[model samples]
Target: MNEEEIVQYFKCQLQEDTNVATAVAAIKTLLEFLKRDTGKDYDKCKKMMSERGELFLKRISMSRNKITTLCCPFIKDGAKILTHAYSKVVLKVLEEAAASKNFSVYVTESQPDLSGKIMAEALRNRNVPVTLILDAAVGYIMEKVDLVIVGAEGVVESGGIINKIGTNQMAVCAKAQNKPFYVVAESFKFVRLFPLNQRDVPDKFKYKADTQQQDLLEEHPWIDYTSPSLITMLFTDLGVLTPSAISDELIKLYL
Candidate 1:
């Protein structure tokens, strides 16, 4: 395929799935395929790429399941869990834990897209008690919750995380209230990025591709960065990791 066609195909696949694990896996697989100097046998490359893509998808699914199962013990009976945005891994953790321990979940409105409403509805279907809250009320209810858990778009080399907008605010609130702030993400979400601040985050990762605003000041960012210090720990298929230990894991994986 031509360069432009490859770029367009990559964008389409990313847009199709917002799951960080799945999206990054696809991107990595694509990059690996593109790097190969396959001699005129492009058809062989196509078939091999297709097979690898399927395996990556399965690995992502397994990673999520393992992390969720590990997180089950953290959800004690009658505990209240606070979450921001929609995360399939977080949802699975709640649902699986519910079978043995009854608990409640507080979901932020997760604005601009209202993805939290979808999360609330999904939990309700699973018979988990759900409370939908305004984005501004995260602090107001922080003291009432035992812990704060959320998903991430990317886990940077600094051990900080980039997630949906307002995640930073939620993490700050949790720290102030002495509540544990946990991040549940697949190891694949770990990227080589080191965003020093919110502004350092790439715009393509923050905004939709079709955004046509005349000025960036006129639009709200879709994501924000939460510093590593605010996080209590991270739950991943690799095992529960401390924020400080993330760099070591990244080195093992990427170096």
Candidate 2:
């Protein structure tokens, strides 16, 4: 295996594996194997790459199909959509419905990673009108937006959403504004860990550096959780779900 072959194998394995840790371990092994094999097999590598691409497309198609069936009907023409973070599902939904000429999106410039900037650029390329706002502006802008959509990193059985640090504030604002807030995520992100209280939620914040003049450490970490009630809906590869509906839908995964 060469570089291309190793990448293709990783993609293929990712398509089949739902366990994040296991998938990562498998990719590491594949990379190690490729490093040991110096011989480059261009033809074989190309074939594997093609197959991996096809599998990637298939998985995306599956997710798109589910979202189209479950959520498209609820989208109003010319609605203002608000989203934070970068999500393939959210992008695909916008793309699939672009012809409707029905929606414009507002995206936050998610700090630290600034993933939202990448999403904004992609949406612009697709000719989707996007309003890029700072994280703090979300509440102020929420009143102007008709809907709130966010991507989740992990979802608990109790229906709390673990996402970018600012996400909880966004959800809180959306609730205060009485706006509909939705989470667009894949079912794989759901986690079994149930926090007994808000305090039980992990402290994703960490100190990164210390400035001598300021006498303070600069901490930049990721992730926060929003309580279940703050979310209006959850869109997954399976379907649109309410917070209360999550546990039942998740049980199907075990079967």
Candidate 3:
């Protein structure tokens, strides 16, 4: 299928699935499979797409497992983790940690959608200790946090991440407090885009808030770029890596 068709197919799937990591993986795998289609052979394309879909599912499962197994070691006894927004991979690691160890999580009410609240409730349902906070309170809670872990929407070539709008500030706070800021993401989330500034990020990520007050609309953004310099490490399926190591991996895999 063409790009538009592929996008629409996944858009429908996204409406049915709330996990960003899964949707992203599915999209990436489908696109990669299509990119290798040299002939417009419909029958062969369907067969290949089906195979790619199965591979995508398996990759997602393994990636989550690898991340949780590797990253849970960081969640020591009585550890306090501060997080922004909701990432399925991040939640999986936290869940795995809580199953065997005692730890607490502080989630920011990532605004526009308050996805952090959703994350907090998910953890509470699992009987894991959790605290909810406002997006602006990250700095206030930084001192008490042993580590900062969040999810990524996309990881650019520069090693920065596009994530919930408040994540950049949260990373900045963690850096200032000498805390480790980590990102939980699958390899598929890495893209070639190298965004230098907030303005360089894709416009599609900007939220259009509809409110009675005009100024309030202008202030709401769905996502923002967090520079790699602020991140302590990235917990990816490939392994735990420094931000600077991302480029080498991308070259080995895709170049």
Candidate 4:
């Protein structure tokens, strides 16, 4: 593939793989290619990257809008929604629902990156009342929360959820609490491969040991996988699905 074609392929693959580092590397390679092919036009290359980023953002936003429109009718007014991490899909959902003033949200300050802090801040800026809690507090808070709404980094055909490190625990807590734990994600994030189970999957949390604090690596992995039964629904660009429906939905994506 040529420079642009390779970049586009990488985007598509990374969207499926949900590997942020890989995506970044691919983007960097594309930038290098641009510099080589169209010398001294760094500004033009930057502009192209910005525009492409915007287009990807818009696609995800549209997907989130579709899921929200489908699911909102089922959500009661003033429902307490719990979420983790900073996801564009999650942000778009809250943004779209902001005008309706339909629901209140609780977010976890996802450790390490503290991505949820960004989400909470965005919601608060939009005038949405947000309760920010520590990662360990999710279980204690789940009893009071009506529903758990999380975003996925990647999903597999077996209905497994790959997301921020603390999400699996939250899903377990929601299951114990008998509360609905839903995943809000774009269909593009779904991976077609299936693992034997959680143990068989590769750990997503490896970082350079000497570069960062030892405790940081000890405490948090970048992602965790939640079992299918713990999830009540999977909200995607297509529509809302129960765990049993994920395989079928995923198949259609490839077909």
By lDDT, the best candidate is: 1
lDDT of 2 by residue, 153-246 (tens): 8888888788877888999999999998888787777888676555576442222232222233344546777899899999888777889888
Clashes of each: 0, 1, 0, 0
lDDT tens readout by residue for model 3, 133-243? 988788999999999999999988888899988899999999999999999999998888889889898564655432222354356678899999999999999999898
Which stretch of 10 consecutive residues in model 1 shows the poorest summed lDDT?
208-217
**Superior by lDDT: candidate 2 or candidate 4:** 4
Global lDDT scores for all candidate models: 0.88, 0.78, 0.86, 0.78
Q: Of the candidates shown, which would achieve the greatest TM-score relative to the real structure?
A: 1
Clashing pairs in 1: none
What is the per-residue lDDT of model 4 for residues 1-255, given as tens digits with 9 covering 90 to 100?
A: 666776667766653344455676858776786667755577787799899999998987688779888666555778888999898777777777767767889999998889889999999998888999999999888888888878888887888788888889999999988998888887888887676555666643323232232454364457777889788888888777887788998788888
Ranking by TM-score: 1, 3, 4, 2
Off by over 4 Å in 3: 1-41, 208-219
Q: Positional deviation of 71 in candidate 1, in angstroms?
A: 1.2
Determine which window of 10 residues in candidate 3 has minimal summed lDDT: 208-217
lDDT of model 4, residue 127: 87
How much lDDT does candidate 4 score?
0.78
Kindly report which residue stretches of model 1 are placed more than 4 angstroms away from their true locations once superposed. Answer: 1-40, 209-213
| Candidate 1 lDDT over residue span 169-199, tens digit each | 9999998989999999999999999888888
Comparing 3 and 4 by TM-score, which wins? 3
